[model samples]
Target chain A: MRNRFNEQLEQLNVELIKMGALCEEAISAATKAYVEGDRELGERARSLEQDIDHKERDIESQCMKLLLRQQPVAKDLRAVSAALRMISDMERIGDQAADIAEIARYMEKSAILRQVPMEEMALAAIKMVTDSVDSFVRGDLALAHSVIAQDDQVDSLFLSVREKLTALIAGGENGGLCLDLLMIAKYFERIGDHACNIAQWVEYAITGDYEDD
Target chain B: MRNRFNEQLEQLNVELIKMGALCEEAISAATKAYVEGDRELGERARSLEQDIDHKERDIESQCMKLLLRQQPVAKDLRAVSAALRMISDMERIGDQAADIAEIARYMEKSAILRQVPMEEMALAAIKMVTDSVDSFVRGDLALAHSVIAQDDQVDSLFLSVREKLTALIAGGENGGLCLDLLMIAKYFERIGDHACNIAQWVEYAITGDYEDD
Candidate 1:
C-alpha cells in the first residue's frame, strides 16, 4: 500500500508538470501570434488552451481520487490538496493566454504595438509560470519564493507599458490599437499574478505554511 | 457518527453563506463608490474585501479538516472538494470588487462616468454571486443554471459600455475617466465569470457531472 501511494504521488507530479508545460506552450504560441501577426498561431494557442483545460480536469480528478482512496494524512494530504489548488491558477493562465491570442487574431496587422514591449512581459510571465510549477514538483521553497518575488517586476513592467500607451494616446494615437494593447498588458500582468498564486500554493504544499495568507 | 458528519456539513454551508454575503456587500459598496464618486466608500469596500479574504482561509481550513478527519467517500468527498474549488472563485470576486473600488478611489471626482450604466452591471454581478452560493448550499440546480445563463447579459453589458466609452473618446472626451470606467466594467464582467464558475462547481458537487468541459 505504501509503495503504491508513493508511486501515485510521483504520477501526480508528472501530470502537474505536463499541465504546466501546456500553459507555457499556450502562452508562447499566443505571444508569437501577437508579435508576428500570425493569425494561424492564435489557432494553435487556442487549441493548446483547450488541452490545458482538459489536463486540469484530469489532474484534478487524479488528486481527488488519491485523496479519497489513499486517505493520506499530514504532508501527503497537503501535497495533494495543493495540487488541486494549483491547477485552477494554471487554468486561468491558459485562459489569459488564449485571450491574448484571441486579440492577436483580430488586431490590425499594422498596429504600432512595438513600443509596448509585450514580448518581454510575456517571457517573464511564462518563466514565472514554469518556475512556480517546478517549485511545486521539486519541493523547492527557494524557487517558489523567487517566483513570488518576481511578480513585482512583471507588475512594474505592466505599469510602464500602460504609461507608454497612455502617453501615445495623449499624442493622438489610434484608440483601437491602444485599447487592445492595454488589454494584452493587463492579461500578462494577471498571468503573473496567477503564477504567484501557484507558487504560494507550492509553499503550503511543501512546508505546510501558506505564507501569503 | 453519521449525525456528527452531517452536522459539520451543515456548518460548512453556513460559513459559505456568510462569505457570500461579504462578497455581495463588498461589491455593492464598491459599485456605490464608483457611481457616487465616494472615496470613503472605497475604503469600506476595501475593508470588506479583507474580511472576505479572511473568511476564505477560514472556510478552506474547515473544509480540509472535514475531509481529513471524516474521510468522506463518494458524494461526500465530492461535496467537500467542490467547496474547496468554490472558495477560490469567491475569493476572486472579492479581489475584483476591491480592484474596482481601488480605481474609484483615485478617479477624478468630476469624471463623467454616468453613461456606462455600471450600477446595473454591479447589481447583476452581485445577484449571480449570491445566487451561485445559494444554489451550492441548497443544491438547487435550477438556480445554478440561471446564474450560468446570466453571464451573457453581463458580458453584453460590458461590450455596450466599452462601445459607449469608445464613442465618447472619439468625440474628444477625457481618456482617463473612460479608461477607469472600462476597467471597472471589466472587473464586473470578470466577477460574473467567477460566479459562473462557482455555479458550475455546484453542479459537480450535487450531480457529479462536470458539464462545462
Candidate 2:
C-alpha cells in the first residue's frame, strides 16, 4: 500500500508537469499571436486553455481520491494540499493566457508591440512560470524563491509598459489600441502573480511553511 | 461526534459571513473614497483589508483542523473542500477591493465618477458579493445563480466605463487620469468575478456540481 501511494504521488507529479507545460505553451502562443498579429495562434492558445481546465479537474479528483483512501498525514498531507492549491494557480495562469489570446484576436492589424516592451515582459513572465513549475516538480525551495523574486521584474516591466502606453496616448496615438495593449500588459502581470502563487505553494509543500507576502 | 462536527461547521459558516461582510465594506469604502476623493475612506478600506487577511488565515487553520480531525466523508467532505475553494475567492475579493482603494488614494482630485456609471457598477458588484455570501450561508442555489447573472451587468458597466474613458482621452482629457479610472473599473470587474467564483463554490458545496462557464 505504501508503494502504491508513492506511485500515485509520482503520477500526480507527472500530471502537474504536463499541466504546467500546457500553460507555458498557451502563454507562448498568445504572446506570439500578439506580437506577430496572428489570430490563428491565439485560437490555438484558447484550445490549450480548455485542455488545462480538464487537466485541473482530473488532478483534483486524483488528489481527492488519495486523500480519501490513503488518509495521508504530515508531509504527505502537505504535499497533497499544496497540489490542490497549486493547480488553482496553474489554472488561473492558463485562463490569463487565454485572456491574453482573446485580446490578441481583437487587436488591430497595426503592430503595437514595438511601442512597449511587451515581448520582453511576456518572455519574463513565461520564464517565471516555467521555473515555478520546475521548482514544484523537483521540490526545490531555492528555485521556488528565485521564481518569487522574478515577480518584481515582471511588475516593474508592467509599470514601464504602462508608462510607454501613456506616452503613446499623449503623443496622439490611437487611444483604443493603446488601451488594448495596456490590458494585455496587465494580463501578463497577472500571469506573473499566478506563477508566484504556484511557487509559494511549492514552498509550502516542501517546507510546510506558507510564506506570507 | 456528529453534533460536534455540525457545530464546528456552523462556526465556519459564521466566520465566512464575517469575511464576506468585510469584503463588502472594503469595496463600499473604496467606492465612496473614489467618488468623494476621500483619502481617509481609502485608508479605512486598506485597514479593513488587513483584518480580512487575518480572518482568512484564521479560518484556513480552522478548516485544516476540521479536515484532519474529523476525517469527514461524502457531504461533509464536500463542504470542507468547498469552504477551501470559497475562502480563496473571498480572499481575492478582499485583495481586489484593497487594490481599488489604493487606486482611489492616487486618483486626481477631480470628480471622474460623474463621467462614468462607476457608482452604479460598484453598487452592483457589492450586491453580487453580498448575495453570493448569502447564498453560501443559506445554501440557496437560486440566490447563487442570481449573483452569477449579475456578473454580466458588472462586465457591461466596465465596457461602458472604458468607452467613456476612451472618449475622454480622445477629447484631450488627461490620459493618465483616464487610465487610472479604467484600472479602478477593472478592479471592480475583478471583484465581481471573485464573487461569481464564490457562488460557484457555494453551488458545489450544496449540489456537488462544479458549474463550468
Candidate 3:
C-alpha cells in the first residue's frame, strides 16, 4: 500500500507538470494571436481552452481520489493540497488566456489595434507564469520568492499600459479599440496575479506559512 | 474530547462570522465615504481593517488546532476547512474595501468629485457581501446560488461605470478626475468578486463542489 501510494503521488506530480505546460502554451498562443492579429490562432486558442478545462477537471479528481484513498498526512498532504490549489490558479491562467483570445477576435472584427504595449504586457505575464510553475516543480523556494517580487514589475507594466490607453482614449483616438486594449491588459495583469498566487501556495506547501499582500 | 472539539468548531464559526460582519461594515463605510466624499468614513474603514486581519489570524490558528487535534472527517472536516477558506476570502473582501477607501482618499485629495456611479456600484457590492455571508451563516445553497448569479450584474455595473468614466474622460469634461472615479468603481467590482468567492466557498462547504464560471 505504501509503494502504491507513493507511485500515485509521483503520477500526480507528473500530471501537474503537464497541466502547467498546457497553461504556459495557452498563454503563449493567446498572446501571439493577439499580438499578430491572427484570427486562425485565436480560433485555435478557443478550442485549446476546452482541453485545458478537461485537464483541470481530471487533475482535480485525481487529487481528490488520492486524498480519499491514501489519506495522506504531513508533507504528502501538503503536497497534494498544494497541487489542488495550484490547479485552481492554473485554470484561472487558462481563463485569462482565453479572455485575451476573445479580445483578439474582437480586435479582428474592429480592424483597429490600440497599441503594442498589450503584447509586451502579455509576454511579461507569461514569463511570470512560466517561472512560478518551474519553481513549483523544482521545489525552489528562492526562485518562487524572486517570482513573487517580479510580480511588481508586471503590475507596473500593466499600470503604465492602462495609463497610456486611457490617455489615448482621452485624446479621442480609437476610443472603443483602446478600451478593448485596456481590458486585454487587465487580463494579463490578472494572469500575473494568478501566477503570484501559485508561487505563494508553493511557498506555503514548503514552509507552512501563507502571506497576503 | 468530542465536546471540546465541538466547542472549537463553534468558536471558529463565531470568529468567521465576526470577520464577515467587519468586512460588511468596512464596505458599507467605504461606500458611504465614496458617496458623500467623506474622508472620515474612509479613515474609519482603514482603521477597521486591522481588526479584521487580527481576527483572521485568530480564526486560522483555531482551525489549525482543530485539524491537528480532532482529526475531523466527512461533514466536520468540510466545515472546518470551509471556515479556513472563508476567512481567506473574507480577508480579501476587507482588502477590497480598504482599496475603495484608498480611492476615496484619492478623490478627497484631488478634490474633484463628480459623484460618478461609484455609490451605486458600492451599494450593489455591499449587498452581495451581506447576502453571501448571511447565506453562509444559514448554510443556504439557494442564497449562495443567487449570489453567484448576481455577480454578472455586478460585472455589468462595473462595465457601465467604466464606459461612463471613459466617456467623461474622452470628452475632457471631468478635468481628468474620471480616472480616479474609474479606480473607485473597479475597487467596488473587486469587492463584489470576493463576495462571490465567499458564497461559492460556502456552497462548497455544504455540497463539496466548486462551481466556476
lDDT of each: 0.88, 0.89, 0.78
Clashes of each: 0, 0, 0
Q: Which residue pairs in model 1 clash with each other? A: none
The fraction of reference A/B contacts recovered in model 3 reads: 0.11
Candidate 2, pairs of clashing residues: none
Tens digit per residue, CA lDDT, model 3, A38-114: 88887777766777778877886687667666777777778877787788778778877887899788674443353
State how far residue B150 of model 1 sits from its true place (Å): 0.8
lDDT of candidate 3 over B11-130, digit per residue (tens): 777777789889989999888887777899999898878788888878866765676667777777778767866787777678778878887776644433443566677778888988
After TM-score superposition, the amount by which residue A206's alpha carbon in candidate 3 deviates from its true location, in angstroms, is 2.9
> What tens digits encode model 2's per-residue C-alpha lDDT throughout B1-213?
899999999999999999999999999999998888889999999898888888987887788778777878878988888888888888888888888889888877765569888998999999999999999988999999999999999999999999988888898777777778888889999899999999998898889899867
True contacts kept of each: 0.08, 0.25, 0.11
Where does candidate 3 clash, by residue pair?
none
- Determine which window of 10 residues in candidate 1 chain B has minimal summed lDDT: B109-118
Against the correct fold, how does model 1 do in TM-score?
A: 0.96
